[model samples]
Structures are given as structure tokens and as C-alpha cells.
Target: MRSFVRVLLGLALVFAGTSHLTFARQEFRAQVPELVPIDEDTTVLASGVAEIGLGSALVLASRRRRLVGTVVALFFVAVFPGNIAQWLNRRDGFGLDSDEKRIARLFGQPLLVAAALWSTRGGSRQRS
Candidate 1:
């Protein structure tokens, strides 16, 4: 079950990353925080690359799966501020136009973090 969820999350990340580099580039830009030092487009592109690398690690890493998961969770945590910025600044992206929708989207970040950790945890053996 964990493996299944991990793979699904990995694939989802890959797809999202691909969208960041392509069709959804503009949408992702809306999520970039104004305080980010880099240009919005560059931030999006770099994050897209990061997502791809992390997603691939989630799918492929075995001996270090827990480490990969930790990194993935950290990545999610790292991006959370951008989500908060979007909500606070009323920036629309990924169809989260309303304040309510944006607020609701914020709730999903923790779940992603939890999922990343849970899915990569060692099963019934020893916790890493």
C-alpha cells in the first residue's frame, strides 16, 4: 500500500513538474512569492526541475527511500510559503481564484508532506 501511494505521488509530481515547464508555466508563476529573489519564471523552472529530480528519487530510491521521503517532505514544506503568499496576496493559480479556494488549497500541503513520509516508512521492520 505504501509503495503504491509512493509511486502515485511520484508520478503526480512528475506530471506537475512537466506542466510547470510547459502549459502550466504561467499558472505556476502566479504562485511564486513576490519576495522570491529570482524571476518568477526562473523560480518556476528551477522548482520544476527539482520536482522532477525528487519525484524520480521517490520512485527509484530503495536503500535510501526514507531519506528521499524526508527530502520530499522538506521540499513540500519549503514551498508552502509560496502557497501562503498566493492566498495572502490574492494571487490566483491552479483554479484557486477565491480566498476560500486558496485557503482550502493550503490545507493540502500538510497532507502531501505526511504522505511523503508515510509512504516511504519501513513497514513492520524498523523505523528509519
Candidate 2:
């Protein structure tokens, strides 16, 4: 069951990461116009690639589980700034609203971070 959950979580991350990598330049720009000046497209693409790599590592071997978890956690923390940037700018870019909706969108980052941490820790536990 635990491994199943881990694989599911990994797949989810992989999908999301791939999506970001695929459309980071366009979708991200469309979602947050201000990001244009900040070179967000490149940053998001790099992050997406990092996410894919980390997600792949998570399902590789139990011996490296801790390392993979640590890297994923770090990646989550690293990308948090982009979330904050979007919130602060509050512009409709990536099909997201630029106004009040920004508040809800801002909360998503911490939730994702929490989930990533939970998945990592849960996967690292010894099975009964």
C-alpha cells in the first residue's frame, strides 16, 4: 500500500512537471504577465525538469529513498518563490485570475509542499 501511494504520488509529480516543462514558456507567461520581465519561462522550465528528475528518482530504489525525498523537498522549497511572485503580482497570466483568486492560488504552494513532504516521509518509513 505504501509503495502504491508513493508511485501514485511520483506519477502525479511527473505529470505536473512534464506539463510545466512543455508549456513553461507560454502558459506561465500567459498566466502572469509581469513574469515576462523576470524571465519566468526559463526558470519554470528548469524547475519542471528538476521535478521530473526527482520524481523519477523517488521510485527507483529503497536504498536511495531518503536522498530522493530530500531532493524533492528541496525542490518544493525552491519553487515556492515563484508561487509568491505570482501572488504578489496578482496578474491573470496562466489562466488564473489576477485578483481575489490570487489568494486561493497562493495557498496552493504550501499545500503542495506539505504533500511532497508527507509523501517523502511516508515512503521512507519501514513497512510492517
Give per-model TM-scores: 0.95, 0.72
lDDT (tens digit, per residue) of candidate 1 on 20-82: 999999999988998999999999999999999899998987788899999999999999999
Per-model CA lDDT versus the true structure: 0.93, 0.64
Residue 56 of model 2: what lDDT? 78
Candidate topping lDDT: 1
Put down candidate 2 lDDT per residue, 90-122, tens digits, no spaces. 656565675667677767767666555565565
Q: Which residue runs of candidate 2 sit more than 4 Å off their true CA positions?
A: 30-38, 122-128
Summing lDDT over every window of 10 consecutive residues in candidate 1, give the lowest-scoring window: 119-128
